[model samples]
Target: MNDLRIYIHIPFCKQRCSYCDFVTYDDKSYLMHSYFKALDTEIALNRQYIEKSNITSVFFGGGTPSYPDAKFIKAALNKFDLAEDAEVTIEANPGTVDFEKLSIYREAGINRISFGVQSFENDMLIIMGRIHDRSMAIRNIKDAKKAGFDNISIDLMHGYPLQTEEGFRNSLSSVVDLGVTHVSCYSLKVGEDTPLQSMLDKGLLPEIDDEKDRNMYKAAQGYLQANGYIQYEIANFARPGFQCRHNIGYWVLDEYLGFGAGAHSYYNGRRFSNITVLGEYIRSLNELKLPEDYSETIDMEESIKEFMILGLRMTDGISINVFSQKFNRGLYSVYGNEIKDCIDSGLLISNGEKIKLTQNGLDFANKVFRKFI
Candidate 1:
């Protein structure tokens, strides 16, 4: 049996950003007692999924996991059956973490910390409606290190409304200089129905230029790679042996359970998502029922399509042998024409039976991925 991975969503934030659409709110006064009870019940019901006592990774993502009280976090962690060496990580905002909370989380079995340091520029931080300034983020990093947390990752973003290439580089350099083990850099997307979309429509904010976004991404890749960080995923770079095991579990299509409002889980050929609305989530869970509002069991062709699309996102592409083993079919027999066509088009390369994206393919990754989709 494959080791199970766990994801716990902390669906609260000190404030909501302007360009955000994630299922989180700014209210601090939520039904904490009721929420934890529901979560505990869900955990007990789903504990049977961890066959062979195999639980390898646990990730705490947001709203902002660090935004809550430390005691609440400790209480929540006590419910799970975590492996001794499991890669336990918590997502944190800069100002939300302190030495005391860090100690508490570490004591509670969290060994990794991923900080949301979107930018090191004060102006950009304000533009993004982030609560922490550059100083607070830097201080948090130092304090975390002082608290004996070495395995750390930082999240940064590019292509903000008024961001420049120089400004982006400065942010990257600052984090790199801080000596984090991993970094995840993502390009800004102006999704439909987001506050950013409204701003763009009203001419309050300029539209995101695709070319500029591409340039920034390429620059990030070059700079980070030059600094000895390997690009494991398209948006994630890590020091040797320090890749995010939890996220890699997702990209590799490994089984994981999602617990919290708006969380999604995939296991036993089924994918289900919890309710996105907070009130609805609490209501369903409080009633001692699973909060799965949407679900789909992936089929053969859809599974293959997802395999190709997601596998290409990693620096290590898809393996024909692995595919063959998975489907009990020959790789050439199944994807011979498609593979040959992609290779001829200079979008893919083959190493033995493993197929991966070429540099050009990575640049136009969406197009390459869409071929399979």
Candidate 2:
């Protein structure tokens, strides 16, 4: 059986950011007890999948996995039949983690810590409605190291409404200075009906600069690599062997089981998700029913398209031999025209048995991906 990965959602965020649309709650912390009970029930109910495959990685993602009592996280993690050297990780908010909580997490088997330190600029943190300042973020990294957590990562964002190109570059520089093992840098998207979007519409905030966003992204690619980090994926950079295994399992379309409300799963070509509403999620589990809300069996053509689109997101790109072995089809037989077009346009490079994006392709990645769709 292939390696199975697990994603445990902890939606108890202490506060919500302005440009967020993730299914998490700041006001619903009062329901934490019931939610964890539901999560436990959901995990127990997936015994068949859990037993068959060796769980290689477990990711505790969140509103803030570090915000909740550490005991809750430990209890939930203990349910997994994990491999001995499993790369277990927890996503944390800098202001939410401390030495005590981190110790509990390490004791419970977590080996990696990923902090959500969006920016080094204090004013940008405030604009994004984040609680932690630059100092707190730096302190959290130091404290995690003190807690004996060596494999650490941090999340960063670019393209805020008033963000300058230099500011984003500085954030990247700070990460290199902090000496964390991994970095995931994402461009901010102001969702419709989100507070940030509302502010833009009302002229309360300036618009995000597209040129600056692109420049910042390109800068990180150069700067991080110069500092000895490798760009494994479009948004992720890491020291060699420090890449996020849980996410790589995702990009490769490997089987994964997700627990907790609003969680999604992909296994055996089937994609499914749990009920997103907190109240309803808890109620279903209480009634001894699975909280699965929706599912779909991916068709062959859709699968091929996804394989190409997602594979291209990684810096290593897609492998020809693996694709052929899995699909039993020649690479050029299906998407030869698309591949040739991308290569001709200076957007992709077909080197030996691997196909990947070119330097310019990083700027117009969506265009290359759109060809497959």
Name the top lDDT candidate.
Answer: 2
Local accuracy by lDDT, each model:
0.86, 0.91
Candidate 1 TM-score over all chains jointly: 0.96
State each model's C-alpha RMSD to the native: 1.5, 0.9
lDDT of 2 by residue, 183-284 (tens): 998999877788998999999998888988888899889999999999999899999999999898888888889999899999888999999899999999
Provide the lDDT at 32 for model 1: 56
TM-score of each: 0.96, 0.98
Query: Model 1 off-target regions past 4 Å?
Result: none
Q: In lDDT terms, how accurate is model 2?
A: 0.91
The regions of model 2 sitting more than 4 angstroms off are none
Q: In lDDT terms, how accurate is model 1?
A: 0.86
Candidate 2 lDDT at 356 equals 96
